[model samples]
Target: MQIFARITSPATQSLTTYRPTPSTISFTVSTRPVPRTLPARLLFYLSILVRIILGILALALLWAKWRITFPIEGDISKGVRAELTTWVLGSSAGQAATRISTRLQWRLLIPGALGVLWGVCRRGYTEESLLVLSGLGIQTSTSSPTYLSTATTRFIPTTSIQDIFIHEAFKGFEVRFYLAIVVQGEEDVVVVFPNLLPRRRILEEVWRGARACLHELQPKSKF
Candidate 1:
């Protein structure tokens, strides 16, 4: 009976022996996110190209102005005559000079006129005031007949005098004169006197005062 029991136990132990099992997990692959680039690089390059083209055009214009030379021939007097004839006939030199002068005049006159207009318009007459500065001297309002009479008597006695130079600021002069006259209503007529002074010390003082006033009113610096 003991031998039979031992045989049965050995058979049970053999049935319970460990066996290896295959893993069920699969391997995972990680990928990184790709960075995107901006498209503004093309626009930047185009702007640079445009600026270079403009610079080249400007240089060409300057060269044309300087390189247009008239060749002299024959006697000195004859050569001068020939040169004058060529210039009158729109020679290269004449053309160059014309182009340069026209461009220069346009550049100078347009901005200058605009600046003058801006200054005049900016100083629109609202009330009577007096301004004294380094380059500009006493700018008095000429809105009233009494003020106009006083200014005329103090500066120009004759109405025929179109303009007068007044020494103002330290070493600057202002050209002062009547600009226009306006009739607002019955018994309400006003004369406008505009003063044109150098945009140096005299204008700077006024600008500073204006800036201060603006800051005080706005409580912030715009410039």
Candidate 2:
């Protein structure tokens, strides 16, 4: 990964306390991007009985969809089919129910519901990243655990950036260092890597690199 953005200046490096102030910080901070793929270790919250009920309902739906003659039909089996068949009447009603069940069955709902449940139970990030483009704006992104959801993002144009600073704040009982951006026309500063607020040294690295790339520095970027 590109950790720093310093220009080679023979005189600049040798001279102490000179124009560049040691370095400029440009921040395209990072945390690994979360993969949308289902994790190898996943937890399911449904009780065994509830899951069995769902499975029976699924089997029943398959029976209806393909017109299988069932050996047994119970609350666990006919649960969904019986409910939908309630809407209309006749021998053809079963056919209608079968048609509707094809669309509403567990084939689609299980995966979707499981995805939502996974997101709720596993409250953590998969990926978080920041990107800085010279003379352009910067972009920050956060990846969600579930592929069903989109990544959250924001972009701040270069012209709207007032300053980038490192701030110390108390999270719980301890102080933490975080990189923040001063955006034009915004009262509250934008925080970088808010979730993964790394250590001071890391922030310092990003802070210097971000500034170096975005602004002209001491010794003034000589040719």
Candidate 3:
């Protein structure tokens, strides 16, 4: 990882307000990044299934209404036009369907977001060392930032860091997702977060913190 850009003093000052402790840095990340273990992978896919089911149900409701409002005969009579208009844009059922779709989307966001937040709070970072990691997903304004679980904190000496790589690629929709942090002897830690900020900027900040520790260990970095 490289700190391509230096953070401005004013911007740094503003961010310091959130760092309650000295020499501490924090960021939100996902709790589970597409599990590698069999059991975890199964659970991850099961969650996807639940979301798919919800989406299918929403589409099915809309399709049912569409079929009822406009039969295959393709009638264009004045009464038929009125009924179609009511069912699609003006009827109570139409309104109900719209609300249901919105509600289901919100339901998916809740668990998906909360699970990551809970993980971060419990494992975001360890206090004893320079590296800190918590929950699973990127942090949210609604989450409690400092409520970290000490047990999950592991201190990897700055010298042990061989290379820091942040891999970014688009999953879809102009939103490039997935960030992976590959450590020397451990499994790669990959995270999936919303692309609110550019990925490079986030990586820069993370590298800045990690570098701070590494620089103290070795004034001249090897890589």
Candidate 4:
């Protein structure tokens, strides 16, 4: 009975008695989807279009104002004086004053209008925007040799020679040649020119005058 039971039992079966072959399995892998690149291209083109439009407008406005002078005659000094006179006179001045007033108004209006248009158009381009922002409110003046010479001579009498030397040497070309003396304080004087160049002779003369003044103030000191 035990032998019959063993013969029927699965555990008692030998390795050679019966065997089943293993089956191989196959798998299918899905490929990943490619990313779309159209958005990036669209952004690049938009940026380029903004830059071109801004550049063209800025150039056109600049060209229009290139040879055109403020105050019509390029006489800023006279225009300023005339404008101030008109303001002071109120209604007393006659036809000449009226014509001058009209001209000044146009001079101011034309440049101001052009500037506004340029600013609006320039906002579109990144490079032009950067440049315009960087130079906002900055102005440049080119002084003739006569102006520099006259300024140096005129400044000496008003300022202490010592102060002038120290101011010129320490501050250099930054002192406003025209209105250095008229400025009330040290800081104002420093800020006025901020980019002026004094001649060597002028520098030496200022130094000598300052030293003499110092000697007069302190006779005991050799300086």
TM-scores, one per candidate: 0.19, 0.48, 0.29, 0.19
Model 2: number of backbone collisions: 18
Task: Give a tens-digit lDDT track for model 1, residues 1-223.
Answer: 9988876642110001111312111111111112244556666567557655554445444434333433445586377666665555386655754476456644664455445434433422222333322222223343323222333212111222222233333323634322222222324222222332222343334344422332332235578
* Candidate scoring better on lDDT of 3 and 4: 3
Residue 50, candidate 3: Cα error in Å is: 29
What is the model-wide C-alpha lDDT for candidate 1?
0.35
lDDT of 4: 0.34
Q: Could you give candidate 3's per-residue lDDT for residues 91-177 as a string of tens digits?
A: 676676655544454456446445544543442221221233221112222222346422233444444445545565655565453
lDDT of each: 0.35, 0.60, 0.45, 0.34
**C-alpha lDDT (0 to 100) for residue 221 of candidate 2:** 47
Q: Could you give candidate 2's per-residue lDDT for residues 1-223 as a string of tens digits?
A: 2333333311111101112333322333333332344552232333334555555545445546544334336665467665554433234745554666657656665565455455444434355566666667778777666555777899898899999999999999989888899999999999987766767877777777677766652246456
> How would you encode candidate 4's per-residue C-alpha lDDT over 67-166 as one tens digit per residue?
2333334465468766664454354433333434445545664575566555544322110000000111111122223211221112222233223233
TM-score for model 2?
0.48
Superposing all C-alpha atoms, what RMSD in Å does each candidate have to the true structure? 38.2, 15.1, 18.4, 37.6
Error of 4 at 114 (Å): 9.0
lDDT of 3: 0.45
